[model samples]
Target: MFNTIEHINKENRNWLKSFYFIHKLSFRTLWARKASWVGTFIFSCCLLILFPFGLGTEALQRADIQIGTFWIMNEFVAVLTISRIFSAEQECNGMDLILTSKLQKTSIIAGKISFTAFQIFTLQIPILLLWIIFYNINSNILVNLLNNLFFVSIFFNLGSASLGTLITCLTARSLAKEILLPMLFFPLQSGILLASVSLTIHIGNNSLLGAFSESAWWTILIAYPIIFSTLGILLSDLLLQE
Candidate 1:
């Protein structure tokens, strides 16, 4: 079903070829499940519209809810998309073929992370816009918010991909896959969410006081991607044990 690599150089050459193959497959598979992501997108938008009605329009209330809701929605989107990432391979019976292919596990992890971030970024774009529109946030802060989201998404997606990959691989053969993903994911993710939400609120309030200005939060933003992605790359090979 596959060609043998006759030379070391040829093997190296084909690794990237395999990576791109998986990369494109990952992106295409994400969009193929558009209904799932679309439902989350529409649901988030509705929640944004209804938040003010449910929580009152006071500035303090809006500020608190804006950052909290946006971050949760982003995290939720990551879970919704990423939880299914590995399951897609298992569901199609391609897990064995993929793990045994010419591609290195790190290459597979890189390809998967690239596409996962891409999907999350695309989904968050409209949600961000809706957040600004519905919350009456300052228009001038739009660029700032996007900049923050850019960094936060990188950190969040890295952690999400790591946890998602780990959990999915471990739970792929489990009878209660859905129940296990979130149970394991949210606990590992709480720190990232806390830091992201605080930083976002600081950006909105036009102040960098307290937790937002703390170096610890910045470290988390910088370290999360590096740590989680590195871990994912390292631990990704463990999937073969299953």
Candidate 2:
């Protein structure tokens, strides 16, 4: 039991060190171009605001459109936000420094993921607040909406981050990243949007317990991120080699 406890402690220490190193790298990357990051945040906020107007009053009344618009906005932002992670590093010539550092590749990747997740979370804040302010949703509905947003954010962000990392690893240069990232991301984004939107609409129109009772759709939304994140980590070294 003592030996097991010591081994667990050592593993925990290693994990914490990895997380700290990655967090620093992630913050530095975001800080390096505060202006661009701010711009992206504002742009995403505007896009989210446009949803109500863009969907029109008729669509807003329709549970399907309302839910669909929310997910579409979320998926769009997530995919775009993550697709740029590594490409940005390469553009600034920071990849070379990162590659040569003593940090483990896993830590570097974790840092990138952490940084991307922060950006995504920051971007979501304005949208969520705006959504709650503008919509006539009730407190219970709002809570449900917020819950859906949280889950969708986690699912889409993790999947996109992993996919972005893989793409960055494969391309090694910025131009290819610009061209290829969207192509690879959009289909997955569409699928996620479809599942989330459909589920949200169903939940919004039905009882909470009833919605939760529904199977398969929720499972898919929750499962995609896990599968993709694992795939991304597993493939990172192989893709990064070139």
Clashing residue pairs, candidate 2?
none
CA displacement after TM-score superposition, residue 81 of candidate 2 (Å): 1.3
At residue 170, what lDDT does model 1 achieve?
Answer: 73
- For candidate 1, the 10 contiguous residues with the lowest summed lDDT are 206-215
Off by over 4 Å in 1: 1-12, 59-61, 206-213
lDDT of 2 by residue, 16-37 (tens): 7866976776567666777546
Clash list (residue pairs), candidate 1: none
Window of ten residues with lowest summed lDDT in model 2: 207-216
lDDT of 2 at 201: 71
All candidates: TM-score: 0.84, 0.80
Please give, for residues 1-242, the per-residue lDDT of candidate 1 as tens digits: 13553576677777788779887776555567676578778877777777667667884245556677777778778887787676666666666678777678777877777677767778888998877777777666667877877887777777677667666777777899889888988887777777777777777775543544556887876676678777777887786453
Residue 166, model 2: lDDT of 61
| True-structure lDDT of candidate 2 | 0.65
Q: After superposition, how far is residue 191 of candidate 1 from its true place, in Å?
A: 1.0
Residue 223 accuracy (lDDT) in model 1: 76
Q: What are the Cα lDDT values of the candidates?
A: 0.73, 0.65
